[model samples]
Target: MAIFEKTPQTKAILDDTEKLVCTIANAQNINKHTEYILRVHRGVSKEDKWNVSHRYRDFAALHGALQAARRDLPLPPKKLLGNMHPSFIAERQIALQNYINEVLKHTILALSLNVRCFLDPSNYPANLTEQALQTVSIALRGEGRYELKGPLPEIGWRIRKHYFMVTDTESHANCLLCWQSYGPDRHLCDKDLQTAFKCLQNLSHPHIDQILAIHNLETGAYVVRKVHETGTLRDMIYGTEYSKSYLSKYGNPKTRKPLTDGQIAHYGLQLLQALKFLHDKGLPHGHIHPGNIAIENQKVLLLDIENTLLGVANVHRPYIREHRKTSSAEAIDVYSFGRTLYEMALAETLEEPYCDIFPCNMSNDLVSVLRLCLSSSSCKHGMPTIESLLRHPLFSRPLVMGNGVHSDGATSLRVPSQLKEEIKMAVAVMEARLKAEQKLVRGAKREVRIQEILGSEEEMRKQKRRAKKRESVWKSTSSLAETVRSQSVSTASSPTPPHHTSDAPACTNGSSSTSASSAPLASPVAAGGTQQTKVTNEAPATNGRSALLSAICSFDKTRLSRINSE
Candidate 1:
């Protein structure tokens, strides 16, 4: 079945694991799970007991009396299950209970998943409506020996249930992941399922995990996806390497060195490129963070993309599409992701005490953009953007590392350049916006506040722009970095060459310019017989190269603006 088509939950179930559970449950003698009401032709029927009877004993007695009364009666056509014996009713009751219990469990898994639930990988009947009836006949005939069959069963399930031992403190949802399933999942609303399925199938990315298949079983359509046995990013941060530095950031004390700046940049770039690709498809990898990302197939793979959607364009999709009651849309998800990103990225953003000089952990240009994304409607400042952030001085040059405010060695994860540039430019546009505000903070100076305000406004506008830009740039950067990284790794003993046109022009020589004031715009501004140099320090490391390039480009573009302002 096509993943996009929205169909009712007819023959939907994961697998036979539920039946196993039911077998065990019957052995224990617990009441049937009555949540699923019986509809029979409609779905799982919920009518209680036989006829109007509620108690099991009453059902047994009623059926028993009827059988006894008809003892001499021409033996009611012995076609259905071993013609009713004296105790057949009681046996039938137990068998029906078993069937109901097993079906219920399987149904639950297909409906929703949590730590305690998962999908079963198994076969199902082609025609789901009569799956149980067909199964008995098929089993009696010894597998494929049945020759009197008409059309074969097309869609149904082999899914059953099993009793899973769970704990009180740890919820069932904390562990189980779906291995497979059938049809429209209750929790995975049609919209989300369709969107996620499309993303999983159509993305066709090498770094992304490929969906193996989509099935159209009678239970409904289901999908098969690749699983990474390795682990998740969260497992690494909380449990493994690069832990020591991050220990201080949290209450837990652990020792592990943070990833080197280079590593962060490398992975961060990959993420941005991936997001860019999604954007190109009129979608957004809304949840773009280290935890949601994975290293697989020798590259990073984005997980949980089914939860995301097209960027700003879909902000108002609910109003347009008369479908699911979705209070939470993809845009909201993106904004939420941005908040998460502010916490996980480099030290500067993490240590943000004031809005003015919020460091551009990615590219200086993207800080403003990141800021806009970081802003909320409740905040006095408006939304930020990528292009404006790019214009900010933070992105105008490469970033310097050592300004961490967190103690106990809080290692910084470099914001990806794609993110960096996107945010920086966004922030610039946001900060410069002339939007009217109701009131102002009493203590903050207008001059100082103006910069913050203007910077914020400019960044907001730029962020929207960056979201639309081609993500291929990230791939281009990755290709270049990979070449450099491999070559650099191989030539560990060799002395590195001098800075040149190939390296950074402004930073060719180590002594190029440590101070931002040394740029062409760093001329003397005379005041009271003294030339007061407005100093802006460049961020350290590879970020510096990015900033230097940005600065050169900005300078080249704004000759007219600079001349006019001067």
Candidate 2:
């Protein structure tokens, strides 16, 4: 009986598998400064949570490191003053949260070593490269068959996986050495792992590259394979730049050199033959992609066939788990092969798995093969087997080698009866595990879809509320403008009253009389039917009063004199 127990490292791997959700939960004041406590939640469960405290300087350091790859980071600006204040700290905390969220949102930045270490130091240590090197060195020291060359840095996309160049001591031929964590899903015990490695070492086919050596370690395993200087098929189609980051490698398709129709037909047929051979021996190359294919002397050599036994997560696991139809181990391989073919045909990556419409320029026969593997109808019913694909019209003709050798004449692969039985059992176990994982993934996807719908509806509601508020504000402003406009119109249209001095005594007569000079002031108003009161005030004054006031006094004197004469 085999026994398996989930360790802390296994739990950590499981936690890492979940989508990361980071938030600055709160800010704490310590040592006369503020430190933000970031609550990192990996999954929906509250139990899968951890907190990391960081200062503004820490965020700045992360920003500086990432600025080269990502220019538009939302890092908060540094504050020279009042940074320690509560309000400033709070605002900075939110800004930092947004910055980290933005970083995590991008796949490239999130996978970068700097960002990973910053978010989870315990999981992604700064000396991760050194540690991997040391582990491989120790393993190689024990097995003196291969000489370890210097480390190959950032060569592949998998973060946990490390690569190193080595030379086979016996053959004196250079080979590639790779080490990756056993992962959380590995159920095989040490004994089974050893047996599996031995089976893989003995396994061989014309189109499949041979595994020189494989060793299972405590935390992970390392595999050695012959290194082709031409690099992977991806490098051949899309030019290689090993120095560039993994994300940048696929960033530019303009530099791609697409294969001709003949080349596709030839290599694709060989790939199918290799897959068929594996199936015949009761094995599945669970991992298949352009990155795992290499070509030398016009022969298509499939690499990384041992990944399945190593128990590392498949590159297309996310896509595979999403569709229930792709639950079987063979179906998964077919789906992956379809994707690889799509890339080869188009010289462009298929961003999504399902593609209904293909370019008109592509060959009809090629598209037909693709449809068999990738069409929704095919996925619903069943993807064609590798043997059937080998019989397809596109690959119906025999592939002739450069040296006048026909590929169809290659000898069939043979495996020991005991080894074959063991492989069959292993494949069964893998299929069962994959089906269980698919179930879990489907449920998780359904929940995610629900949350997205709710979030979208909430966002719509918020937008409507904001629009209503703006409409109300606009209406109030328009009404206030109209009131001011009407007041000005009423003030301009009305007639002005005759000028009077409150300090002057009341007229003796029943009606008060105005002086002649006051007539000029009223004349302009009477002619234009507009107020000139403001214009009259601008006129030069006599003594402390205007000319109109002096005229009023003169008229009053004249009126009194006239009364005396009467």
Candidate 3:
């Protein structure tokens, strides 16, 4: 039996920890080169597994493109000699596998269009933009109300989401057309999704961008909204130089213009009012960022309000998952608003390890509001409500300039009774789904941390074992040296035998006794020679023991140094 049941309709949502895992399952020689068959899956599920084949050149090309972002990529060096040898090919395959694994480990590289297309060409085709344009064109033609002008290439961050410029025939007004896949995370079924879109089309508020038309399809949906010539709020702040590239737009926030205190207050208050209006109707935007907002004549308009119903993941999901208090829909909106505010204030994305400290130059009121929304205490307890944020002193101050003033005073949305209940039910279902997903994410993160701790502990135990082995070697060497020293000392302390036979030799006559006295002297000299020989032999043994001791000491020192360095 499998650990996980296979449900083709239910697609799994991958977290950061469960990144794309690839293995070179096999290799085959084609023409003059070797192509490796890679088995790829986001998680340990047979249903998610897919295979892709690529030659060495493909890997090299991928590395070349991504090298600028990550300089120290572990791409294996190309071999000229014996390149087609089976042994070499096998080794290179392993190296290439590791290189790709390293590449996918990085979130930026993993999410890159190049890498995605390389790994799964079937899904992320090279002509993905063209395919999106075609699908959108067909959908718009079927509706007969809008005419597709041209695609807005590389405009947004989402891979499956595409944007195009379109014109409404009846009004002849230029509008923005967005086509996005329902995706695996979509919370509503087809009927409910249609109802949700219908409800959104009728929504009217001073701060909300009105949806001109909505066409939900089997695979995805197409939405049309009036184009803002000023582009998104992000374009307003970042100068729109790299707006076509999602990475460049977000990766270089510091190089852009930050919102001033007055602008922040003006925009912040309107955003809060918009959120409050939605929350009052039991709806949440779910996606709130600079890019999802538009500025027209100094007034902020919240776009993509139907994204929550679309069941797409939130932009700040990774950050939101870390805080349990953000599980609720309203709280999630508040947290997202806080992040958006941080970016506007500092002209930089709020990085992890969120802090409460703010620049001294910032106003006290601004800092207080930031802390209330972003501080660790706020995450643990709960962020302020959108209504409360509207009442905040930072936003409550009277405007010197008449900014964000709109004639549309109507704050309520009216829909069919059935559609209203459907919208309410959809919002409730989406919120429950978001909360469940967040719980899973938190659990996964906790498990990862626990694994890291266990790995460190295991490494410590190995280090201790190595230290003990070195200590034992040192003890043994010291004992051997001591034994050798003791042997030398005993040999030196024993007294030499006295020449007692000399008295008998002296009593004998001169010539005959002289020969006998010489013989006794020879015996004593032989005894002293034997003692010298013993000492000489012991000296070499002592030298050998000293050498062994020195070698062991050197080895121990080297081992200790290596261990300390590690």
Best by TM-score: 3
lDDT per residue for candidate 3 within 344-435, as digits (tens), equals 88877776625678899998888988898899999978788888887788887776236435345787675666655656766676667656
Tens-place lDDT per residue, model 1, 95-154, is 545543433333222221110121111233323324434433343244232222222211
Best by lDDT: 2
In the order shown, the candidates' Cα RMSDs to the true structure are: 40.9, 11.7, 14.3
Per residue, candidate 2 scores C-alpha lDDT tens digits across 80-165 of 98888888887888788888888887655666677778878888888878888999999999999999878886767677788898
Q: For candidate 3, which ten residues in a row score worst on lDDT?
A: 553-562
- Count of backbone clashes for each model? 116, 0, 0
- Rank candidates, TM-score, best first: 3, 2, 1
Instruction: Give the Å shift of residue 472 in candidate 3.
Output: 4.3
Question: Which of 2 and 3 is ahead in TM-score?
Answer: 3
lDDT for model 3 comes to 0.73
Q: Candidates' lDDT values, in order?
A: 0.35, 0.74, 0.73
